[model samples]
Target chain A: MYYRALGFQKDYAWASHDDIPFSPPKIPLSQATVALVTTAVVDASIPKPVREANSYPIVDVPDHFDTSELSWDKETTHTKDRESYFPINDLRARELRQEFKALAPRFHFVPTEYSQRHTIETDAPLITRHCLEDAVDLAILIPL
Target chain B: MTARTLEAAGIATVVIGSALDILRTAGTPRVIFNDLPLGNPVGKPFDRDMQHRTVSAAFELLFSAEAPGAVKTLPHQWSTQDAWRENFMAVRAEDAATLEALGRATQATRLENKAKGLFRR
Candidate 1:
């Protein structure tokens, strides 16, 4: 769909796998440390038209994300409400209720890279290291 | 793609997305497929009830998914009419030339950024 919409000469070859990686929760949900990963970049300092993969502190999650530059269904919906994408406040309330152990100290941001190799080799490993360092047991991936 | 990689690296993941075809082909481990627009996957803006429901559903899938590649579609509707699907990302004839130029410029900037190794630190 994007290939035709973007007027690419050929179809974008999407990555596929028969053996998908699976890892069951080692601890119960109430005892798991969960983190948030989003395709939306949090830093407004990073100029438009240049998408980069990075991470931000969960403590400073913005009230709204500037998404005018990214591609999405803009006509139907907007990212005016940050919780609609980030949901840090809701997760914090859930944490108070003991729905999970705690929210991770930081959330991760990954760019929607066209190259699957770069995603798998570069971005994925960096995020994996961050998750491990933070001792996160689960991650909720929200792509915008 | 990062979701699967995270799962492989021993951290469980649940993807909340609206693109079923892309999510399925990508082979995400556990998916909470929301049949809404691309950007607002969790729920509509300022709809706290719907947002909470979506997050609760994600947690349910995270706890209940037994195998890899498991997907559960959330029962949420964008609107009563299905017109949005047709116009979801459709480029209007009037905006075609402008959008094409923007796409080219964005790609050029992306390539230049990559060449200069300008990843956020």
Candidate 2:
């Protein structure tokens, strides 16, 4: 309900942390490898939890993973119905591919649920090693 | 996950988010981005230029040491706005119903009734 009231479900959703596709003029790119760390549910061991029955963010589920799921319309809010909520606004990342690949084409993107698991095994440091394994010089950590 | 730990790994990390102050207040203990929302940390899903701009903007934080715990909010990207399940709400409900029906066939609910009668004493 709050998400709808705040317009996040529809439009603001797409405005999440993602890799865009535009090529910048020139930013004097860094030689360091760039990595993306997110809170996306990725443990094959545990099945993804079911969405809360009444928790907000349900209204934004996309209709489909493909194009029928989105609308460029600006008048009314474009609510997603669940085509791929796991993306967490990753559609922006897909669209902005050129932008990210430009900075570091070999960038490594990894998702970890450390915030939820912060008290558990503490996977953050291990995740860091995975990024560094690829010689990650800079890492973009996006938390949910 | 990646932000604070990578920094702990001695790799400079720049964090971005619409809930920067919220995160810091909650004791995130590292850099903060006082910009984008929970879902849209970098920028909206489609605006490449803004997304690129947002991503690069965070990288700029590395050059600043004026504050060990720093935060920055970038230019707001507002597009003539408007628009928004749980992933398993309906499915779980269905699964529960299926199991309940099967139990009734096996008399699980009936078993509860018999137990209640036995304990009525």
Give candidates' CA RMSD values in order.
Answer: 2.6, 13.9
Candidate 1 runs further than 4 Å off: A47-51, B91-121
Off by over 4 Å in 2: A1-29, A41-46, A49-120, B26-37, B77-121
How good is the docking of model 1, by CAPRI class? medium
The digit string of per-residue lDDT tens for model 1 on B35-91 reads 998888899878899899999999888889999999999889988988889887677
Measured with C-alpha atoms, the lDDT of residue A115 in candidate 2 is 28
TM-score of candidate 1 against the unseen true structure: 0.90
> Top TM-score: which candidate number?
1
Cα lDDT of model 1 by residue, A100-132, tens digit: 999999999887777787788888899989999
- Highest DockQ model number: 1
Native-referenced Cα lDDT, model 1: 0.85
Candidate 2: tens digits of C-alpha lDDT, residues B1-121: 3454565565666666655544554333245352433355555655545665666566566554344455666766444331111221123444665644553553454456566562111
The pairs that clash in candidate 1 are: none
